[model samples]
Target: MPENPTTEPTPGLENLLHETRSFPPDPRFAEQANAQAGLYDEAKADRLAFWERQARELVSWRTPFTETLDWSGAPVARWFADGTLNAAYNAVDRHVEAGHGDRVALHFEGEPGDTRTVTYADLQREVSRAANALAALGVTTGDRVVIYLPMLVESVVAMLACARLGAAHSVVFGGFSADALRSRIADAGATLVITADGGYRRGAPSALKPAVDEALEPRNGAEPTTVAHVLVVRRTGQDVAWTEGRDVWWHEALEAADVQHDPVWVEAEHPLFILYTSGTTGKPKGILHTTGGYLTQTAYTHRNVFDLKAETDVYWCTADIGWVTGHSYVVYGPLLNGATQVIYEGTPDSPHQGRWWEIVEKYKVSILYTAPTAIRTFMKWGEEIPDRFDLSSLRVLGSVGESINPEAWMWYRRVIGGGTAPIVDTWWQTETGAIMVSPLPGVTAAKPGSAQVPLPGIAAEVVDDEAHPVPDGGGGYLVLSEPWPSMLRGIWGDLERFKDTYWSRFPGIYFAGDGAKKDEDGDIWLLGRVDDVMNVSGHRLSTTEIESALVSHEYVAEAAVVGAADDTTGQAVVAFVILIGEFADRAADDAGADAVQTALRNHVARQIGAIAKPRKILVVPELPKTRSGKIMRRLLRDVAENRAVGDATTLADSSVMTLIASGLAKPSTSSED
Candidate 1:
């Protein structure tokens, strides 16, 4: 936690890539910005006082907190320990009470071209009714509920209803397998499940109830699950095997219940929700987030980071309800700020490739936030697709999920924002609960592909393996030197594991699993996860940098880099790239594919030094990605090392691995010398 640990140089990650392009905030944008340059100085003067001010100004606390933070428990921090609040009330009811009931809370756009608009009053009534229905089914304070539904309006209602009753809700992605769902259900000891019969995907009705039924079914020699009821939403109206005693229709339950329910006021440290993140071990880690502090930070960051004008701006974050970005930006953050937002239900390319732009144009979305993977996919589709649509309403753009390459960032700024909007590339994990490192959009001069710096109240630094802070223009591990409000309380049911995983790495500092580098200006640049760093000829190179180098090429649209075992170099870099739509035909033949791969290899060598060049480059049609749009580099490594593909059930399309593996058999460009 020392501001300056030892300054001794160490052999850590090699920062070989440099980005010099910078874009400052527009004068007009900065004039009306919510976060001014003075905010940083205020936070630096008194960090705790700054947070206490934010907590008071942003959130609607039932009982004001006296104590700001209690870090006496070491790794486990108690923020705003004496405060009391209700997340659902702050999100829904308070806006209704403030005469904003007529304001649009959600602009729901179904993938099948169906649409519905819900106001704050409408949301309050629905959430209250859902809470009543849940209470009738024996769900109350301290109870756990598992939600396994698609991106439906009811999904948001379900999460809010759980929060309203002080019951923790754990949402599992609808794309997850039955085994994955069952593991989360068992770990949370959930008593009820909320799901739809099915949801629309790619113009087809995909059954979801079957997965829920399979997950809840009796296992051989396993203990019975705690689930007492199954609440089903009729999204697709797909036929499902009925369990007469345990199942209840969503609409019927809400219709039968009263539309009036009281919000449960819980203490600051009360458990709000438990979201599961993938762990090194087979089991998923249930990240426990408490009530008051989590709401405080999420609301604060959401308002300032995007320079939100809640009354005028129509915000949209293209993340599903299952991910943490959705938990923060899509649900809690925007609603807490009384901002109207859009929520889509299907893939970006269902009926056509222009589906997302069409929605944005229809909604006049001003603030847009999405992942880099999505931007790269749009790049592969070409810029002409978005050029057909009117995106003049977009003002501020944002990126999340992972580190973005500079080319994708520039494309997004040019094509989507019309080269005028500032992009806020954010860095945070599921455990962090909200955005930690991000540009203020209006105050800071934005740097392409860099998170830039920690937010006003956060303390983050790049440190070497010896816990010494790396000097400016050095690369090392990213660590949080101080506790933040929204930091995860602990791994659910396993305090020791939480201590061992995050705390033990630096004794007291929370070591983020990702590696990072500091520029000459001391700005932080994320270098993906430490496990993805490749060791070639004793140089520890970042996969993100190599992938960025490949993507910087004009022909390349997207790239994924992995480290495969090499007898001579210990680990060699292998890259998979997708060409732009116009150039796809150039790589259609074996000879043409080899030519394109060779060009990309040379491009990387020139972008960084020759030591950072990819050992092998394969022109792939697509890379394996998860439902949340993160590339599965582990599976890519499996294909690169010539090993049998591992469990690919978690991928958005399991067949993607098969295609990538088969592509590996074709002629590839490689070098051994």
Candidate 2:
């Protein structure tokens, strides 16, 4: 018989995971939201019309848009082009005006057990006063203001106030260095800088005023700064150095100003915020999200994806306001829908490891959204800790930041949700302002690691290098084929870089910079970043998939994989892993550590094939991560290749990589040795 050429394996194609495990939504929730399943069909009929309807229905517009989208210029898309809307009014005022003024908007819990519940009415007054104060500080429409603060109500107020006054605000993460904050302020050409005296962290009052002062200092004997004023909030009552005329206290300023500023409507395309994201090279790219479209999608997604019941559900998204998740889910999304949410201002393990669970129990939080790294950390701490608390309030769980491993997903569902709550593993980025691809908790029978599909009105696909669609059970690049309302307008002041970074990859299609796979049922499973996809010889393998495979092992709790320089293959897989429970004790002894490393390598070989097995594995107490719980794989790659790590300053614990490097110096007993 002649050979069947079509059935043969391709030379350069890599082996892919055929993950078939699935979890259906809770029957009660599904029954309650039968109409949500119909949105897919409605959006399929006409995506533009669906978005137009969503925009009109979700937000209160001062001037309605005639056109839904104008994409003639390709990459530069304008959604709700002719619309005019006040983002702050849509987020706060409308809820209060509709007789929900007494509703609790933010249930703020401070690190020192201090609590404050701000209602819609209270929020409206605070925002109005803030807007008046900002205007008094010489801020006006289109002016840039930099907000660098902790997870306080003041941060939310400052953001909304900027929106109310039609000023574009840039929020720098409180954990960031002065250099990082300064670079963003310079990039945005911000005139006003808002910061707190300090914030509480790990049961200690950390001073932030010093960083702010240093950031404003003259560099290389240059001119002082472009900043006109520095507004300070007294959070911890910590004394700070006064800049005389340039500095003003929040209380004094707001007290002196009139609290009757009206919200101003801005054009739909007018920039709402300039959020800077770290790029692989050069300065961080300031992602620009505009008004009407961004707000509409954020509000709509928050309502549907979480199945938020504004009056009942106590929602919480564990993200800092410095990030996009905080902007959309934590603030704009929930407030726009009149939803009550818990906002905490401390690390999850501060004072107690059960802090998050305590808050969930205390607030009766029905919807819990958080990052997968935090989940893995919770898993590492053991289920017994959470077992001590009453987490029965949790009805729906969410995972973001990175593609969640199946093991972590199962742990999150079983341990946290008690196996009943649905998990909505979302896939989006800073570039896409809101959740782009996520399972509707009430509609999807979600697979453990897969995002399942794009939401209604979002067009996404897994395509090969030639821009052709990849077959099911194949791996390819993930791209958004259609522009959505919440898509970023451009990289602020660097339209060319934005075009080159996102659009130039696939011409018209928005290359998401992530590798992905389509399952046999055509559900999309996100692989990590395209840069994270390593080439072994000529075959491509996803670092996230391998890391998932590693974490699926009984002993491993969390894993980070990096592609290191290799002579035999183009790049070799190197892994740094943290063990928990019994594995941690076993890894303490030299011989047991050797045996465990061998077992993990074999485990990965069995689970994902030998090609995906790590060439080297280091059993470490911790992995390098940022304050936001993102693993610093770039530093790991540097360590793996035996090169000097560029910067360790951004790490939550700068000593972590040093510890890992020291651990790697020990002998290897594996067959790969």
Candidate 3:
């Protein structure tokens, strides 16, 4: 009867794609959009000018960029060809020098009830101390160091210190196994390791130093390990086996170092970090981003995309420092812009599902950016959880990690964002280094399921398998037409692998890995990976579409879909649905759940088509996700095909396998069919 009773759209929202979309046109926002418009124009006309303008946006030296981009060397691409600037200075000193020192840079709340307010000045000192400590460890420009710490101050410190010395840092998620850490360490050939003795996890101390120790076990030769020293912070004072002359305590080492280390100026192309990305190689691919150019784009995007006003805004990107979202948004993006932000070291539902809402209320966070998986988790907990705390200060919300299903997207827009804040459905990857295709808050009209339009300077196109542009409403591969300032340099050790993996996908174009469909208005809707698209009865269907169909079912909590081989059709879609707890408990006995399961199958057929319906629907307890909220569909596919799974090392809970395995090989039937 009532038209769904949805919240009214965000005020002053501009439609970057639809020329006819109306807006109130605020002067300040218009002026900014105008200036940003110039950069986009320059980028399209004279590429060099585009990059030079990007550098000028941030604090820089007397001399400006002499050259913009150089890719004459096949694999290694250089950005801001000949420029000098310091990442630490750009992030810390410049903000402090600009009289924003009193502004809170990091509202860091530890998992163990400890709080630290790090202002710009304080951050400068901490970064300097860390820099001096790192320098004393013989770290210099171009040196690569492995950071294996938990979500504590030292993780941020290690990143800043590496930038200060012009050294590249690789931060492996603390949840990763020693073998995973060891692969990254050896690949980077890092001379130093940074970690904590132990860090708080769900109100308890968990050992991290031991993992680092086991990782370095392979290099126990007389000449000493490639990791010359391990800088361990005493988070829990847990007993750690001392490797005489190799293990250095943080308090003793860094506290003794000078707190006024000068920042080292670096070329625009000087490597800032080597973050690893997952792929078929089994060995992780290092996605390298440079200092000046990377931060230039990062700062610009944070300002315009989030409509951030540093002096007043309390921004919080609830991403662990392990992933690219943290590298761009959590630490570098906010700090570079001199914005007050919150960083917590726990899950959304640690002691209670209300943890995130409490943090937002406690810090009075205005802009909260998080993931779809988390939003869905909050949704599972329901409105009562958010109602427990005052989250009215929140003005902007963000989604990343994976495509947010329309249902979860609508739920997030209403519940977490309080119905008025703009949701920036950001889409990018570790290789991209920054947000590329996204809806700019307050500027772009909101789209529930679509990312809306490419950022002004980003040139994205949906191309068919043959590398030809696809028409409107046609699903195809996503590709970048040009390289931007923050594009990855190359794969760390193997340039050929980098070329083969990303570049070779479609020659001359940068492959985005994800499949996409552009609307008649040229707005992009991200489907999952190219490998994720399923061909059912010769009709192409995205796993995202099928999963979305499954989620639309009332009883389903979350769904993961994969294509499995069948003799009749090319492939059959296999779905795994995690039922809602109430329904799950009710259906604990076999016969009770069968009716709901049948309803789910018919739901998918009605939503898309009969051809898109899955041949099998497995009921699993939970879908595997990284510390960041990305589902490991690769592992799910392994489970679907009755194949032994690959790596479960990064999962937050290894016991989830027991839950998933228990459901496998059980007879399943589609409800409606």
Candidate 4:
């Protein structure tokens, strides 16, 4: 990808570049961050000293660190290497010691309308008990534990317990297929597995333990798993086939265990958790984050980025425990800060479309961090649903997972924020462990679609193919010039892959795999993934740019654009769009669909240029997304290329592909004019 493409602006595209509204930092919240005054300057002066200061200030260390950072090894850097700390103690025991034991730690809302509130003291006791049970099961220091459970409190307890025992936990998303789970477990060589009998989804019980069973079974010439034991949390009490020697119930184990186990402090560089993220090659990379550095950055970023008011704010990060967002925000960050938060155990739309708003109103949630996918879904559902409820409690809104379109960003600010709150569009990944680029609510004047700038103390830039920094307003690959505290230590047991995937791309700089650009004010805008930038003729048009143009139209709620294989143009843009509330009903009629589709094609032509217009427009009810709400664009690429669809195991609803394929059989409302 080249930075600042020299191509002239496509004619008549000016209207699409609407002037974005600027939001200034809130006066009251601006001073709330303890490190706000001299943070960025101090970091710039000495990055090592800044991180060391954050490590010491954020948590109680059992042994003080002598070294701040050791980047002498180049891509494999170490931070606070000599320091000793316990993640569970920081997240739980220390908060209890501060006499904030009675403060609510988790406000668990299950999908079936059940709720449980756990205090810090209660959490500490539970974690201690679970730690003891793990010890009894022979889970020791440096051992890997695979946690495959839902958004239950037990899942949180199990993870903290693993931390308590100095065991690295790898949490596979509950929606992952047995093969996916098996591969992660096999790669990590996990000894113990924690799962639930079943979980609530779409207002009913869904079996999960069966997946674990299948994963453990050696089918299709696969070897038997390394898992020695499976600990089950009786979430829905659904009957599971018993494996006498391998399985034990959570209630049974905890019943026999004492709640007085002490947490052991480990070296700062000791592995905290192994989070497996998918690579382009279809292999799962276990992103490794350590104790002191990962925690320090996670806590620091969460506190300042969200402008968290620990005592006053009711925070909710709508991410599953499987991904990094949940690990950083829902578990470590919020818990370390002793912040009260809502943790839901189900999808946003199970019983009804307004479940999230109901929870927000019910809990008076002040800070809401969610993905753009959910926001767009809400847009599809219409604003009247949220209008029925009071949403004045929300003060800050956030976006994660992917780059939010300007249209979606504005709608999120205006509708969900009640036109008062500021939106923080965060950019980070599983490898980064915490937020890297994002607008600080009370600091920057935000651009709707842009991540704006890297967070203070983080050094990031958009660079051209030769690793040279691109000029302001230029488009290029995004890279981190300096090593940060929260960067992944290695790809578990595959240091070479870690280095090759991230470091090899840009020599010493960390390649983020995304395309980016800076505006006239030097604010950064993320163009989707580098692979997502399609070559149409000799012009490289980003899928994000085309999708943004499609979504800018009032009738389109969400849009996904893929470049299909073409003989003439090399790759032709094929778009899938979801219509807004009444538009769906209207678009269902063939005549209306053709008219609207033609208008949208012209809309994109006018927005960018005829070169960027889609060759076909398919209006569908839903796009195939993962359970984590990420659009599986690879599948869309397969659809566009007319290839046999690859594995649909990761999709939230794999059956949607059938409908889409069937829909594709009909004459498309396409315009090649």
Candidate 5:
């Protein structure tokens, strides 16, 4: 690779950060990997043919697809349109029929020390029973069901059961408020709701049924909900007020239903599921994904990207089933690949700080996938906690959800991966349905904090405002040049909004709504969301870049940067950071806090440039993050701009904002620029 280039500022975005470190694939792992260099060449030779081959090989289609793609619909593509398949059958029943019935499918671990081991055959029976039960409740094909349950094996069963009946399932995160749940239920026009009495969190039972009851109640003379029945799982055995005829016990219904129901075969274009995008303020856009294409891509990515050896490897993705990551990776992808995975139902720190590593050690997990926020939290808790466990079973590490900082990437590689395991930092969205851009662990040399090149059969590029491709060492908006098999069909019931939001930005291309830059090596590095980009004195700076620089400092553990309103500069950089465990005590006093803040500001200036340095730095004990482990920078912007903190109900811990706001009331460590 050429040396990092020094160029003038570009029109789209100013390229600032430079990374030279790269780790090539280990020869031994590469030799036996599922994906090889030829994979890319094969895709390049004929993209549609490559995807067709993948569909034919990875998925078990009830009726084979003769057609690969039909772009006659433009933005809303029809992939494998004429094919027929059952997602639940492909994920569960097919594996059982192939004599893998005894293979473990799920290893469920509850926060309160409860455990359940389920096999492929067991999953098939459970799904069949649930499908029968749902059918008895008048949930037929094309009906929508809302699932608001904790991360339990039952949650997985519910989703697969819905798929088995050809009914679309929309899983709302358990952490969401009643209003959020009601909005989604109303939008989807769901007929049935599946929830739990409560689930254990932080070593205690957290009631979930109340939220469901609240959501079902008509508020402000609103029309009665379309919901006909509520299926409640007795997780915590808590007393829940029930509407006698409307609410039914999950176990009782399943026990009465026969376990011989057949899977419903539907066209490839049948809606598989609808997942609403998180962190949205008003009405949420429901991203609709179809069966054949979604299953094909997710299965292919799961097998190759993680170098998954289904028979030998134990994979675990630490995501709740409510989010897209949980839907795609935790439930669909891994299960479709016939891979055994661990599913945990609690926060990382419940019971103890070492709960996650303990589960990893117990399960002998070979592949671990998680978000950078969790990794940074583990960093704050100190490495000694993880060091206490035996992590040698871990072979590959994966990062998702958002752009990871280079420092967090390094820490994850060194401490968690045991220095040699490959890390695949995947980049994709709910709209994409599956992984799009990610380094093939066995083919490309890994670069810290960079997603690298697009995956085989995926066409992505960094382009300027004119939709022209940026140079190798330039920064611009990221766009997908061609439609992929797993691309979302459209936002449910809102075709025009879908076109305006994603397609209107770049004609004939899918704008990812993210800013990105290419290194001199032509590797792509995500620069956070374009909405988070700051304009400082006419220079556009990525909050991700500045946060990366801050985390690069030895004393800083995690950081969130926001652009505050400025009279002269238009926008000024303001940062809130959490210190490492050892350095956390230093921020107790004003002098130490000032010294630490100044040092981070100076480090950012040296790392990127003076223009990227933060104007003010606040040493926060914790950053507000959502349940999915994404930092809530909008809340920080409120604090930075001296406005009242916005609605923090969605945060994992609303008290975090209060602590940060109180800390800001004290003396701030402003840079003397």
Candidate 6:
């Protein structure tokens, strides 16, 4: 007998969980995915068979042989038994052979008003030139190269060039400071660094080559392996310090190098790239991935999840290639499926809040994948902005980063997606190579904020500290029990850290670092980072809980809370809020401030518990954020804790941080702290 025998069942949830969002894939979409998954599953299910199947998926040689995963060598595991396949040929040749050479491969929109549409033929020529130029610089197969440049057509050119030479490319975010760039360059032992003169940011052209020069400067008086030649593309006309022997222009080199070169054939599990990810602790871990299996999974998932029509639809992912969202959507996944995508070089709010809407209207983008933080920002800008433009072409919308709050999710569903398009509230990490769990648009029942369920081959569960499954209606650490395609091979240069950080949390299980609750209806609700959970007066409190409570108030526009030091209790909650226009009246006067603060505190007390009330509330103008719209909570915490700030390099504007710091120094009169 179930404990809920007396209560009614949560209706429609079962339909919500297992239904395929791809109700009717483009006939061939499901057929291709099903066939691919069948081959992929068979290949991986039995280690030996998996490699054989992966080879079969590729244009393989007449030779195939013994050996599976070579983990015994550590950090140097080889796959594909003893077989060979070319990455560039697979990404280019096979599609061309299938009569897609004339199809538009890249519909590129540059920062300026100019546009360039690169067909498969044009892309092939450019890639051949870049590969030969790289060879001239002594970049051979197995060499690591660091790419730190703006979002331009050249970014794709560089990636393909590296693939052609069988070199591992680590693309550091262009916005990252020299220190961040230095860390990745050193970690990968990259001998070559490719940069650009500069690229656009929020509609303005800025110099990036200078940062590359500074980043490559000899460090700590030690001989540098990376003080090598810096290949710069002249994107912006900014004056640059040109070095004769070490700095070479992209145009000059590409002009001289022969435009005919063959891609190197390597084993499947050979290292592809190392993308560094910083967790809550600020320690960056380099995540590694490979060739054959990665492309296979990305291609299969992209086809099924979006039911992509490569020829008809114009797809655009608003994320920069610096982040994992960009890696999967912008670089690997979409391209592997050979879809037409718009690559914007500016922010959603650049020039004005209407920028994103205008792009979608002009390009008629069929699908848009973005972060939840971006949705909330658009919500902050008001719906009238998006309502001004046409968005009917959109069939699918994607959400990444932290789980979206309910109200914002609804706004995204209605306004940006025009209510009819399905939202894939995707859940994956920098560590996970691609979208691990998300709703397939055709088969999945649309949920406002929920990610829905795991992809067909993924196995996820909610487990407690002891690795036991939690009861229904309970929250626990999100974990994966089985290896899925596109899972990180390991943290670069540190397999032990990989085992200790993720695998060790729950032996033989991959810990997601996020806290999740399986509701009574068996639907998983991601609760942000497990570390986001706080202990206030012996009662467990989620920061999202308080933030959500505060946002629920009509006067509140946005809210962020951080636990601070408290002698009486373990920690005290401090909240920073940006008020809506209606709330402006309250922010202007002492009386209004007191009323709004008290009301918000009372609301949280009622919603959660008395102990969960924020001890201090600081009303502010705006939260410091990245270009992509994620709040810089680390900086906000620095303000709350009254500590010297850390790494203000990536903040949208350091002044916003200065504003926050000054405001936080003086406490609000309504505060209990």
Q: What's the count of clashing pairs in each model shown?
A: 0, 0, 2, 2, 0, 11
Alpha-carbon shift of residue 35 in model 6 (angstroms): 12
Q: Is candidate 3 or candidate 6 better by TM-score?
A: 3
Model 1, backbone clash pairs (residues 3+ apart or across chains), number: 0
Per-candidate Cα RMSD to the true structure, in Å, reads 2.5, 3.1, 5.8, 1.9, 2.8, 5.1
Model 3 lDDT per residue over 96-147, tens place: 8888888888888887678898888988888899999989989998899998
lDDT tens per residue, model 1, 450-487: 99999999999988878788888777789999999999
Residues 1-673, candidate 2: write the lDDT tens digits.
0022122222212333344357776678888762378899999999999999999999999999999999998798999889899999998999888999999999999999999999999999999999999898899999999999999999999999999999999999998999998888888999999999999999999988888899999898655578999999999999899989999999898888776778988999998999999988999999999998999999999998888889889999999999999999998999999999999999999889999999998999999999999999998889999999898988888988999888889899999999888999999999999998889977889888889799989999988777888777666788999999999999999889989999897889999988787777788888788778887766677788788888888899889999988999888888888887787788777898888888998888877777777888887788899988899899988888888876988888998878777654333467653
Write down the worst ten-residue block by lDDT for model 1: 1-10
Model 3 segments beyond 4 Å from truth?
A: 1-48, 219-224, 664-667, 670-673
Give the CA lDDT, 0 to 100, for residue 221 in model 5. 73
Query: Global lDDT of each model?
Result: 0.89, 0.87, 0.78, 0.88, 0.89, 0.73
- Model 4 stretches with alpha carbons more than 4 Å out: 2-18, 31-37, 219-221, 664-673
lDDT of 4: 0.88
Q: Which is the winner by lDDT between candidate 3 and candidate 6?
A: 3
Candidate 5 all-Cα RMSD: 2.8
Clashes of 3: 2
Residues 99-118 of candidate 6: C-alpha lDDT, one tens digit per residue: 88887777776656567788
Candidate 1 vs 5: which has more lDDT: 5
Better model by lDDT, 3 or 5? 5
lDDT of 2 at 404: 89
Where does model 1 exceed 4 Å of error?
A: 1-20, 663-670
Of 3 and 4, the candidate ranking higher by TM-score: 4
Q: Model 5, which residues run further than 4 Å from truth? A: 1-20, 279-281, 664-672
TM-score (C-alpha) between model 4 and the true structure? 0.97
Off by over 4 Å in 2: 1-20, 221-224, 664-667
